[model samples]
Target: MAAGPNEPKSRYLQYLEVVTGSLEEKRRYRQYKARVKRLPENYRTAVEALERYLMHFGPADGAGAMSMYEDLADLFEQSVADGTPIRDIFGADPVEFVEAFMANYPAGQYRARERNRFTSAIQRAAGEDTGQDGTDR
Candidate 1:
């Protein structure tokens, strides 16, 4: 069969693979959300309230949990400077507020893994599976 104007049939297959992989990732996040839903009433209330005033100032990195810890720390400082009202912000105590909120925000470990969810997809699309020889990025 003749290839299309945009690319070969192989490219389409790679696109579909990446898309399906992403969908599976969404399901994982859904499970995580359900668990979060089960948190204690007071904690849930606080998370909900703080989430309503969400803001993400630093780079998400979106490719592994520890990769963005530095970025997450920066966001915390920015959050405080933006007058996020620590008392009303995080559900944790004042002593643990900084570390607690930094860990809870979308900048958490789960979120970090979620960010890297697409790296393999893009790698596969670019034919990088075999020692990343054809990978562009």
Candidate 2:
């Protein structure tokens, strides 16, 4: 998955790829593990929670994870309402949504290390907000 200009090495993006029915998902999961292992301890916890979320809930875990991801969706909706022309949610364009979600999440220690993520998500959203897709405005 290509990490966009203002995106991070996202666990969410990694998660979405593995959750899909793609045949090579196992290999991706291996790379995903390597990626997870390198994250800071705090981020490791979120990745772990995400794993538990996936393992226990199956493909439907996204339903639950949304509590973790929904605010970002809401943020975009608010932006869209205000003439921000972006249209995306959850795993859709996860690079954009994950950063927004992480930036706003009240829990986790990634706040400091995720500075780039927060800023980039905003810029990406702002870029999409310009009615390029005719969905935001």
Evaluated with TM-score, which candidate comes out highest? 1
* Each model's lDDT: 0.47, 0.48
TM-score of each: 0.32, 0.28
Q: What would the per-residue lDDT of candidate 1 be over residues 54-94, giving only the tens digit for each residue?
A: 32432242333223333333444455457565456544564
lDDT of 1: 0.47
Task: Please give, for residues 38-131, the per-residue lDDT of candidate 2 as tens digits.
Answer: 6556445545554564454323333333444333234443554565433333355645544554444343334333654565566667874432
Per-residue lDDT of 30 in model 1: 58
